[model samples]
Target: MVEFAMLVIVGGALVAMVMIYLRGRSGFRVANPESGTLYVTGVSPRPDATGAQYVTITGNLTGPSVPGTVVYGRMAWDVNDWPAIGDLIPVVYPSGKPERWQLSRPGARPGLGS
Candidate 1:
């Protein structure tokens, strides 16, 4: 019984550690943000239940270190304002990490440059 108890405790600890690591990795974002341009590549054929469509966007990194590094992400866009192919949109991403980015909102402070 004691050995079984110990095994359970160890297993629980391992699960907790894995959860923490996974959460941090997905939630990680850099503090110093930089402005980048994202060109619309494609949009989902159907909208979700929320009436939002998944959009595929790709863009080249705009930093000296990762110049020309292309990054891609999928964003949920409103049905009314779906992006068209070849549309350019402003975006902000963490310095050195272009994979994590989001669309830039007007009047909101953008990273690095104003």
Candidate 2:
């Protein structure tokens, strides 16, 4: 009976470890590219953003050279969709630099700043 109990405990521990590992690798944080533009699949308002409404955008790099690159940024948008934690959005870099992950929507009108 003792041996059986030990086996059960060990199995439970192993299962728990696997779950924890998987959860850690779920890819939640937004990875910014070398450019300033942040590629996000979605956007979400920051908890503290009040007047202007700070936002966190999440999206994969859609640029030709860097595909599948996850990106995120903290900024303010005029829209209401409010990207969620896992949404994906496009990004545009002005100088084509990787570190400049700060980007705006592609083909955004001329008045928008870089």
Highest lDDT, which number? 1
TM-score of 1: 0.53
Poorest 10 consecutive residues of model 2 by lDDT?
A: 105-114
For model 2, the stretches where C-alpha displacement exceeds 4 angstroms are 1-51, 85-88, 94-99, 106-114
Error at 34, model 2, angstroms: 12
Compose the digit string of candidate 2's lDDT tens values, residues 53-94: 666666665564555556566765544344554433445443
Q: Provide the global lDDT of candidate 1 against the true structure.
A: 0.64
Instruction: Residues 22-83, candidate 1: write the lDDT tens digits.
Output: 98766554478887776555545545455566756555545434565667777566665656
CA shift of 7, model 1, Å: 28
Residue 36 local lDDT, model 2: 33
Q: Predicted candidate 1: what Cα RMSD to the true structure?
A: 6.1
Superposed by TM-score, candidate 1 places the C-alpha of residue 73 at a distance from the truth, in angstroms, of 1.2
> Clashing residue pairs in candidate 1, if any?
none
